[model samples]
Target: MKKMIALSLLLMAGMMLFARGSKESGKTVVEIWHSNSGPSGTAFDEIVDDFNSTIGEEKGIVIEAIYQGLANDVLTKVKAAASADISSLPDIAQLDATACLDMRNADYLILPESADIEISEIHPAAIEALMSDKGLLGVPFNASSLLFYYNKTLFDSLSLNPPETLDDFAAIAPLLGEKDSTGKVTRYAFAGVPATYELGAFIGAQKGLSYIVDEKNGHMGTPSKVLFEEDGTFRNFLGHWKALYDTGFVNNITSGISTEFAAGRTATMLASSSSLTAVINTVGGRFEVGTAFVPMTDEEATGGVNIGGGAFFLFDSSDAVKTVIEYFVSQDVQMKWAEDTGYLAINTALYDNPEYLAFLDENPAFKVATEQMLQSNPAVTSIWLPSAYQIYYSFQSEIRAVTEDGKDIDEAVHDMATLIQRAIDEYRAQNID
Candidate 1:
């Protein structure tokens, strides 16, 4: 009997391919709230339209796609909405590490018993970070990886090449930095670390650096004194930043002087490869741009992608909701996402196809972004949550205080770490189900 039901479900899914939406018996309304807007947002809308034309409109499962600003913003609005609080929620919603955990923690999300995500289609690192520890919360959307982006016009004038390793990064700092009338660095060379990514790509490039060790354990490490294990590598990493700050080579943190970088005020920066597309599109007519993979230390940066861009999640409801999720997360829908938008296809098979890859070859800007996306480690960090953003801000504040207010590094880091740990505890208590 069980086998019969399983086979029946499979047959229904296969038959869905035949649902062309010309009949009246087909019309399942499944609401999908997401956070993609603008042109890409339009692309998402089209994907739903196609999916509807294919299966939902015919089989009664209509996929409704809604645009809800940034993920954090959506989560706030979602928390306020009464429907979201009830167990019977919309069929689908897009969430990040924190939102996924929060919803799943309260049993507000239902991991499809049959939904074995095509993990191979996705990078493993992202699975560790974005999806729930033991249960899958949502499918990937608009994910990206960090890369080394430089001022190509500046590099050409200076006759320089892009950095491939940490050593190379150190080597170029001096050449790219600018000193003001008082010998103070008015323009910095690199701008990756002082941002929200929290040097995740930098540490990930090294071998065996992860905040989480187990997929089922949705927890991040609480480093006693150091953010990383007491390995000399972390010490070396932080020590270098301290020196850079002291020397005034790196002034702004968290996307340091992006305006400066864009205006050619800064020479080099480390940011999302996805940002490359926008940057190039924004500056393509005016300046020459250069891009390379994020620099490495020991291992190639294949840890997994951090789920930078949000994805459409299937909210908890009934069997109808599950159907909606399946359709949206299907290989078919994901392909449209990659092709029509800047996001690389979450499906690995897309990478294997000569035709799809040829599209990348034709567009160098998208090609670079895709290349970096291919190198991502994973989307979620162990013990990371939206509350971690609070920690991120705290860390940023401490760094600025140390630099601008002349606070001691030891004192600042110690105080900041304590505050962050407290936030983590609070998040766990409030969010951990």
Candidate 2:
């Protein structure tokens, strides 16, 4: 019965693909698999419609944008399509930044430079986030960085400022939080779980910009091992994090974080810049929200937050597909995308545009992520690994073990490194030549 159901779903998907590829007035049909949803999805669809009506119509090219669930789900579909029938694949795919390694290993994409598609206007950090040993792996579409979010009203009441470093966070945690007579925390100074996303920023923000894996964070070549254990990067970050944990004001919970912040139960959070809009909306004007760069490991730290979000991979190297890619990354479209979705515009030229400047002036929250990206160290690029998802969970669990289970920090870090290295070894054994 399960096999029959699976076969039925497969047949349905193939039929849908056939319907999508059916010719319409002899126009070149280009399909794009995307993971955008909610306002971002709506904004992307509008952009696609704009393209279809104007440039697409003029060039006799019709673009079909399909939302294929979240980033992981889209990647799964793309991989399955690659193994089943290459013809079933879309001309383009927008996948999370971490998927670059998988895409590179699969050799399933075409280089934009080879197709004469110019990307000089895009931001260098955004370009570097998707780059590999094979040159550019994808075109950055929706770009974001980690941000520090605080309840401005709470900070102002206590005469406190947003923390600039982990030491500052520890210093201010007790003052910002409230506790019961029994010494149990009733209001948290900070509430968040430092998973792979947050840990990447923390690790990258070391004195010289540390990397989790060698080969320049897997850009120069395939990463065979992680560097956290040898370089003491993880140890340094864990020391600071453990201090923050010892403050008794930090809540290491992941669920209802934004809710806790909005309800005034937590004073601050560390989250993706893309959550800026949603965070503000969830607060519903109850309190003012402020945004800043992710806190550095210490006052002497010189590194910056790594880029997050997704990039577009080209599968069919056609002029129409290139045009679509160019349209998405164009200054005008990028400005609109940033405004609508709270994502950083990949086009660096947008920063100098008079209208964009005015927009930033009006919306200061959206400006923080862009400023951080522009000032980030060149060494701070996205971590590309085939076992990125597994590594994320390992970071979460190991951190929990030290903070909650009273395990030794060194033991936890060692175990985490071992788990990550094992995952990497297994992936390389299965995938790499």
Top candidate when judged by lDDT against the true structure: 2
lDDT of each: 0.59, 0.86
Best by TM-score: 2
* TM value for model 1: 0.77
Number of colliding residue pairs in each model: 32, 0
Q: Candidate 1 local accuracy as lDDT?
A: 0.59
Looking at model 1, report the run of 10 residues with the lowest lDDT sum.
212-221
Quote the lDDT for 406 in model 2: 80
lDDT of 2 by residue, 1-433 (tens): 9999999999999998898777676898899999888778888999999999999999999999999999889999999999998889999999987777778877667877676788999888888887777888888899989999999988999898888889999999999899989988889989987988887788877875888888887888777888988878888888888899899988988688999999989999988887778888889999999888888887766688888899888888988988989999999999999998889998989888999999999988888888988888856887877677778777888887888788887888799888878877887788746
Superposition error at 174 for model 2 (Å): 1.4
Model 1 regions lying over 4 Å from their true place: 1-26, 82-88, 114-120, 178-187, 192-196, 204-207, 212-234, 245-259, 297-307, 317-335, 368-383, 402-408, 428-433
lDDT of 1 by residue, 100-211 (tens): 5555554455554344434455655555555554455556666655556778878887788886665666677788788889887666776534434645554443453443
> On a 0 to 100 scale, what is the lDDT of residue 77 in model 1?
65
